[model samples]
Target: MSLPMTCRRSSPRLLSLCLAIAGALAAQSAIAADSSAATETSDDAAHPPASDTRHAEHAEKSKRAVDLDTVVVTASPLRTTAGDLGKPAAVLAGERLDEDRASSLGETVSSIPGVQSSNFGPGVGRPIIRGLDGPRVSVLSDGLSTEDVSTVSQDHSPAIEPFLADQIEVLKGPSTLLYGSGAIGGVVNVVDGRIPEEAIENGFGGRAEARFFGGDQDGTTDMARIDGGTDRFALHADAVYRNAKDYDTPDGVQANSFIDTKSGAVGGSLLGDWGFVGLSASRFEDGYGNPGEPGDLSAGERGVHLQLRQNRYDLKGGLKDLWGEGNGLRFSFGHTDYDHIEFEGDEPGTTFTKNANEGRVEATFGNRDAWQGAVGVQGTDSTFAAVGEESFVPQTTTRGYGAFGIARRSWGDFQLDFGARVDKVKSEPDAMASRDFTPLSLSLSGGWKLGENWRLTANLDHAERAPVEEELFANGPHIATLAYEVGDPNLDKEAANQLELGLQYKSSLVDAKVSAYYNRFKDFIYLVDTGDQWYWDEENDYLPIRQWSQSNAIFRGFEGEATFHLADNDSGRWDLRAFGDTVRATLADGGGNVPRIPPSRLGAQLRWENGDWRASLGATRVNRQDKVATNETPTAGYTMIDAHAARHFDTGNVGWELFVDGTNLTNQVGRVHTSFLKDDVELPGRSFDVGVRVFF
Candidate 1:
């Protein structure tokens, strides 16, 4: 309960993270008092088969501890497994999520751990959890809701497509009971199974990839995918293309940063054993540039450039064990048609539009000894417009509805979960004002299993939100976050309360987890800076004036991860890892700080594998963000190094991989105080990437 002496300052790395979280809470309280005296002896249940033969020889060590056989359906509406989803989660899959696919999904999940990345460049990025990001972060695709407007700002860009992800979870804190209220600062599901619910293995399969990148913005990418079936029918397809040019910055190249993108998709499904149905269509196109302006003017100079597009359509369905054994049902629907245009250096300076529709339905029932859960209904409709001359938020329409539920239960090693939700939001603006809100939410979580390698978890939440449309109708100049915006239509409705705690460890050679969180807000809708100023002419003169405000806030954080197995036979294996994270937002009455937060980090990595070679190396440090807010400006912390290598090939029927990657590699000059173009972008210098991939 401190901070606010101009956001104080000090650190020996936060005193070594408070002596490593007080030596991991005193070694988890001496291993929970030696597992409660070995479950009161008698060889613990007279050796219930020695814990079922150590769970059948570690059942793949509990899916390699924490990777618990990846099966998350966004924090539960019952797809469970991620250690039963009691919050704090992360998953980005295979080939390290395809070599960290990046076309900005906030630089492809920004290396997990409490995540970060608001770096609006390299074609707009977003994701900023822990300090929250626009519309409180909920970006799904494959679980619906991606009616993009990119939370209405931050240079947009979030039309889903992290190289056609096949996995990308990340459901940190406060997930409004199952994705509503924009997940209240969490949820980033992006699984991309197209539309096949199941079946399509060996009936046919496909994938392809190509990549290239070299320093100062050189780039190229290509992708392809396919699937097939006939157990009643199934099919899917995908495509992508990309180009880049303005990157590089050890002080150079970033001018009008360039990019051009493309996307495609197709789908079909109709199988059935119990049920399945599907449909799909997709398209996206991009043409970027808007390095927040700099250098050489002409062509009617003025700044801002964009050309985006979207066209989507989808329908989904599923059912299984109909009204009995694990009864189930699932549904989804989507439709979108979005548009963007903003060139200013060459006419057409405004034009935004969207036409969206969404739907959802869920059902599932008691899956056993105690209970399992799911229940749902969701809806949305949108129509937005912004016409010429920097139109700033009007001509709009929005609607939403929600109903949710979640449940879970377990005995022995204990486990519990709960959820609830309600929502109704409306906003109409064609002619200026109209608003409505009805938010409600709740959640609970728990877990325990303090032996067999430790575990403990807890979560509590209460959420509510409704205010978007740029916080209720933004009003002017937005030179890409240079600010001069305003919005407030009597803003209200935003309540939050959260708490979390976690600890986990699994053995077969060591693996770990640790977490901490706290949040409390009530009306906390920020964006301030009213030093008043707005004249945007005569060579970009007046700018400040940020508006959109509210008060009472608080945020707290901690994150952790660890891994080690430094050596495992058969000619290959060696690993080591470490991670860290931190957050501290304020203004719960003592107004100070709480702006672009995100500082404090620590990292390490080392690896080497065999069976088709692999390699890795890493380093990270970042930690110099002087709290700030009050004419904010304080950032200076750095240390980065990266490396990678890969190789694999089978060619029996198709399989291959080749890679190389490196970044920053000693050429620093980084800046990303959670970026608003951190004083004119810089972050990406000394780069290299080379790739290839294929599978069948």
Candidate 2:
């Protein structure tokens, strides 16, 4: 494959480092194999059997006052634990996930450090990692891309449902090596377990939940999931429905802020001692109003809304002991058909559609005592089209092919990880010259144990990304942003070099982690105001002109979180947690601050758990953002308070949980700096959600 122009012309050191790491890993693999075979007996006595080691680890974990860091991160190819990863990672599951679930994926995971949400309204929110959003972030479901048009517009919402997820994994910083070149900023993977990889433990199991929201946002949601299997086969099914009315704000009700959505899926798998194969079919439908452009009711004007639908199919298979006892091979494929319609009241305006397919195959091998690694190849093909008066981007077809390798090794108290990926992307716009780009990514991470309870970690990454179709071909009006948009067909690939340092501490009474990162970018792509306007006779007005532009930039940030186990006695167990994050992005060459960057935030939470009862109270303070880019306005910050409580009970053969969650308890008027509608709309205020869950 050809290398990226930037890499070929200016970044020889990055390419050399990647090659050197690959060569060293290849040699280490050979040495590891020989060493493993020669020292099998001696290593057994030193490390104990696998089962024994697991039991001991489990016993040690049980003694910990807090188990938040013990969860395994399924997003990793090697299935590394969150606490053991050399890079920054977070996982939300079990009761914590249940309490944090929201109408949108971004809202669900916004509480994590270094992560925030970009909001158009209550019905639309997408995850923004550090100071980056849009195409820079990749949203996945069960390791496969969601294949949604959310990246095309700031107002669109992700197609995936957060409530259905079994676990949510967030990887911060450059994760292009494991995902794709598009994920130069970060990755968020939602694990729903829609396709069972193993048989149900008791042959049959399921869960059902119903929830209601009161106060500002009046909504109702219901969902159900079932899993069943025989000794050789497994089956799974799930469905969800949600509806909400206009949400209230501190001043008044936010007009046209309503949502309606429904989704369902069915899957089945065949299991055997040698391997397992699974297939799944799913469908999603959503309809939500756009609060930013809520037309004037007194003038008899209708509001704008969006209706979206998608049908998807997935196939996955795995084989054990492919080449040796600890080796395995796995493959996954997904096909998606998506349709979205923008409506002016009851009349359809812009229609968007996409047909996409993606697939990947991976092989994993190595002994735990010496080294472990995975090698994989991935490919994707998609066609996107926009038709209507409001359409801004032309029809286009995009294809990508990639290969990657990752490995990890440990010696005594130090662990090291290295990975490399190369991708070729081709974008073809109708009646336009096709553009091709070869993006390469590389990463190296290491962790050193400073003591029994302290660890230090560092990471270095070099990543490159090809511009998306909209960035290359868009040339019309965009109603969402109220601007006349333009794209450049000759833009070059975007590249970044980043470095991160982290410190972590873990003990029976306390757990803490802190990280600092800096990223330098070449030819960073962003939208710029050209001080021009396009007169529109249809609207009897003029719209600002915004064009896709490129420049050199830098991003720097720090994030930290700490948890303290206060007490554990017959009365109950109490814990307190604190977290804070800050990020700044600026254009190089004195181009000033980047627009729409999230501001600094500090928060704390206190929790109590006793037997079947649990509760928490938290508050967050967001600092005002005054470092605005050219012609950009500043944003005022606010403080938010939230509380959650849940109780578990058993009835016959079924288990039940009742939960109540309250957000924005102070009814504060808050605005998201990253939102395009921040000046026109405020966040929902003072809402309480009550729910019940049933498990059998």
Q: Top model by TM-score, which number?
A: 2
**Top model number, lDDT:** 2
Q: What's the count of clashing pairs in each model shown?
A: 1, 0
Q: For model 2, which pairs clash? A: none
RMSD of 1: 23.4
lDDT of each: 0.76, 0.84
lDDT of 1 by residue, 112-203 (tens): 88888787778888888887987888888877778878787788788877998766887887786677887898888887777866555435
Query: Compared with the true structure, what per-residue lDDT tens digits does model 2 show for residues 22-113?
Result: 34334434443443221112111011212222222222312222254666676787777789999999988666778889999999999999
User: Which pairs of residues clash in candidate 1, taking residues 3 or more apart in a chain or in different chains?
Assistant: 58-61
Q: How close is candidate 2 to the true structure, as a TM-score?
A: 0.91
For candidate 1, give the lDDT: 0.76
- Candidate 1: residue 592 lDDT (0-100): 89
Question: What is candidate 1's CA lDDT for residue 58?
Answer: 23
